[model samples]
Target: MSGALAVIGLGPGSPQTLTPEAAAALDRADALYGYGPYLDRVPAKSGQTRHASDNREEGSRAAAALRHAAQGAKVAMVSGGDPGVFAMAAAVCEQIDRGDAAWRSLDVSVVPGVTAMLAVAARVGAPLGHDFCAISLSDNLKPWGVVERRLDAAAGAGFVIALYNPISRARPWQLGKAFERLRQHLPASTPVVFGRAVGRPDEKIGIYSLDAVDPSAADMATLIIIGSPLTRVIERPGRSPLVYTPRFVEGGH
Candidate 1:
């Protein structure tokens, strides 16, 4: 076992998209760590242990994995979607900042994975087709005041919003704050799409507006796509409803 903690992004749950380097790293891993369901995705390896936990325990879980690596274990800290995008990378860095010599002793590298924002954006014909910013509506690590500031900035700047952790069990009203901020910049007709359990069998994608979105409709599995000022709903003759950002279109009134 080598003294290294590898944070691997397991792409949007497809073996075909797994890069060769990630695959090889998994082969060398003595242990794997990540969200409970996501940890099940990796094929079982000989002598490898799997450490699984809920999403919000990222810091504690990651610190444990770092300890494993410190004690001469080749550990893989897994993140669904991308490791760096709304994933475990930040938690790992935070643990390192505490000056834990065990954390410092281990080599750490982030491996990229597919984020839900990119996946959902492509599914909706490019909601984030232009400059955009992402903000998680969860206040676990941040205060609502800070989240509100960012939400206001994104809306005022007309940047498409890739909202992560929009709503969860414990914190429901944070999303209301997010929508309230958006309303300051966008009109009631602005298109908003709610993508629940994306890329899975029971996946759902629905379009709504700032006023129309139901807060209870969102959960840990859901990812929301709020359109920019330039976004419009293109209802084609026979195709599915499309929510798109017309950022590149010229000569607008």
Candidate 2:
């Protein structure tokens, strides 16, 4: 009797944003495994066990969760935002691909939740209304050159870019470098949004032009959206400005 493994997304950072399906999956889990901060998001259950690890231990954490599930104990691997979006789902799948046959045999499911970019986009209108692509600025897993190339290609092709894992203490300069790269392809007046800890108490969403935007304003918790030339900003009398990209582009279908 193989047990199940559920990769659950806890949404951005708000309990109110957690999906019903994710809540039920968490309820059914006999054990949970995830990064310390993300594991802290899920309320504790009476008999359920939690195994918390460092944020960088995705591979080992996935393996441990799979091993637990293979022993007939229902396990949930938790992630912040949507599990499939540069999160635990890919880690779990990678482990399964190279892991034991029993690990592969375990029943697995991924429960979706609101990812950071979507949450940020909703808070400030839809910059994602047009064609968009997400790229992680972190070079931990891949080469920095790959990130640079993707940024160039995405910007050159006029795709609105959503940057994840933008900056940290160790890699403080990359976001600035990214801004520089974008400036080569985009207008100085292009809209850029820095959404930090969105949906949480300390949430901060700042709208800036590409030339005036400061990379130091963002951290690992921030999700930055770089709008295309067609993106517009609408002002209201007493409300925050709305930022959106028109669905229809000029001259092409």
Candidate 3:
């Protein structure tokens, strides 16, 4: 009596952003598994077993969900934002690859949702309108050297850079260091957008120059976008300025 495993993304803390597929999967599941904060975002379902755990316990939570799914329980593993983007989808897939051979035969699906970076990009106009790449500033799993190298490469390539997990209590100075690396290649007046807790009630958006940016403004909940040399801002009276990059590169066909 095997059951299905649905890896669903709740989007960036907004009910409106949640996809119908993810909503339907949540409604159909007999059990839900995720980080405590993400799991809390889901409405209480009658007779549904909720397995909430710490953010660091993704592998364990994924394994627990898989086990329940193997036992004929329809399980929905929820991830905030897109499940495939630095979230539980990878954790669940890793568990399936390393844990059990039988788990591969179980029905598993990844339901995509709007990612945090895109949500943030929308809130502050279209900073990522052109070519861009996303990089997590957290060095918990990987080394700082790797992050630095990637930042250097991205800056050198003149791509709009979306930074996730910019700052946390444990790894506080990484974001500042990353900015320093970018500042070498980009201009001092390069626009940087900080979208904190995007799509939430307490959301904050701060747009500032590369040199003037207050690194202290960012925290774990923030998503930072460092614009390219071609990015521009349009100021309007009594309105938040709109920041965007042109669709076509300068002197391009």
Best-fitting candidate, measured by TM-score? 2
Q: Model 2, 104-185: lDDT tens per residue?
A: 7789999999999999999999999999999999999999999999999999999999999999999999999999999999
Alpha carbon lDDT of each predicted model: 0.83, 0.96, 0.92
Better of 1 and 2 by TM-score: 2
Please list the residue runs of candidate 1 whose C-alpha ends up more than 4 Å from where it truly belongs after superposition.
Answer: 14-17, 249-253
Give the per-residue lDDT of model 1 (tens digit) for 1-253: 5599889988766676667878888998889998898888889988888988987798899889888888898889988888898788888998998858657767899888778887777777878877788888877778888888888888888888889988766887777777877887898988888887666777788888877877778887778888887888888898878888876856655
Evaluation by lDDT, superior candidate among 2 and 3: 2
Q: Which window of 10 residues has the lowest lDDT sum in candidate 1?
A: 244-253
Q: Which 10-residue window in model 2 sums to the lowest lDDT?
A: 97-106
Q: How close is candidate 3 to the true structure, as a TM-score?
A: 0.98
Which pairs in model 3 have colliding backbones? none
Candidates 2 and 3 compared: the better one by TM-score is: 2
The alpha-carbon lDDT assigned to residue 184 of candidate 3 equals 92
Q: What is the lDDT of residue 164 in candidate 2?
A: 100
For each candidate in turn, give its C-alpha RMSD to the true structure in angstroms: 2.4, 0.7, 0.8
Q: For candidate 3, what is the lDDT?
A: 0.92
The digit string of per-residue lDDT tens for model 3 on 1-253 reads 7798999999999899999999999999999999999999999999998989999998999999998899998999999999999999999999999998879989999999999999999987889889999999988789999999999999899899999999988888888899989999999988999998888899999999999898899998998999999888889899999999888986899
